[model samples]
Target: MSVNLYRFGKTVVTIILKPLFRIQTIGTESFPKDGGVLICANHIDNLDPPVVGLTSPRVIHFMAKEELFHVPILKQILPTINVFPVKRGMSDKGALKKGLKLLKEGEVLGLFPEGTRSKTGELGKGLAGAGFFALRTNAAVVPCAIIGPYKPFQKLRVVYGKPIDFSQYREQKISPEEATEVIMDEIRKLISAHK
Candidate 1:
């Protein structure tokens, strides 16, 4: 049902992107087959979500900006593809609860710790949300990187790094802010590797 629609959307996106961006993915084998998983990446542009969703082996439920959900068509279609809205800047308790519930059900949750796109392509300071969820759920956090010029007719790369365990950090009483730094550092390395 929903899964079929997701795959259909991915197929459509892949077909559309193939002739435009030369999409290349590396280290996909590191993505977990099943479990409560979190895919944390650096945000560069609006295309980051769909690009990651289309390339990922698993169906990715993205935390989209709340504004996108208000668009007429997307308002009706987003839920079918598992995209939920999250208000930016201030905390959105409902979105956080939804994310936790999804992870508890062993779903793949995609998030960008930077919260907003980086216009310069340089990785920015991460928000604590990703680490907070990782610590709370003890989910495997897979660091992802999106590289290359973010435009049509250019080579774009999606790189995945090994899953990071936040359980130890949680046990050691490390703050979510500290854990975010660690996760973002790994994401930085992945992006650097491909450059």
Candidate 2:
């Protein structure tokens, strides 16, 4: 990955979003300075990824839907911005392996646990992929919430909750589904708190 390119992209995104949305980022200190980390957030709008990207203290490798890559411009731009395509609603082992590899390299990964955007803007049930990655790599799981509609000039808050420790569960017998709920619950709390 090109560090300079990522920085440039971040700068451009910040310039466009900051004044337009008046974005507010909270609890960014909760992100670990090093090591593999999984950032799980609730998905409401298509803009959520860039919103999280601009506010994040570290570079985030986000998993986007495969369809987005089909767009000519996005196909060229997404990879340059550290966005990888993930096939949703089915088992896409290639994407899963890519995410796992990134995590193992101590990269921060951004994912929406719900698998897709919510039509009602309500938090939905989390899929197990995030939990599986967390368990496999033992990465720090940070629950994030993006609060507010995407209206121009409105206050858009991207709140990051404390890192959830999976050390205990790592040693025990726990299903990925159960672990996912733990992540979702924290995200739910963040949305409620910020709203």
Tens-digit lDDT track of model 1 for 83-184: 999999999999999999889889899999999989888999999899888888967899999997877888999999999877678889888899899999
TM-score of candidate 2 on Cα atoms, chains taken together: 0.97
Clashing pairs in 1: none
Clash counts per candidate, in order, are 0, 0
Candidate 2 C-alpha lDDT tens digits along 1-195: 878889998899899998899999999987899999999999999889888999989999999899999999989988988999998879999999999999999999999999988999999999999888878887899999999788999999999999998988778858889889989999999999999
For all candidates in order, the CA lDDT equals: 0.89, 0.91
Candidate 1 segments exceeding 4 Å error: none
Candidate 2 residue spans exceeding 4 A from truth: none
Query: Quick one: best TM-score, which candidate?
Result: 2
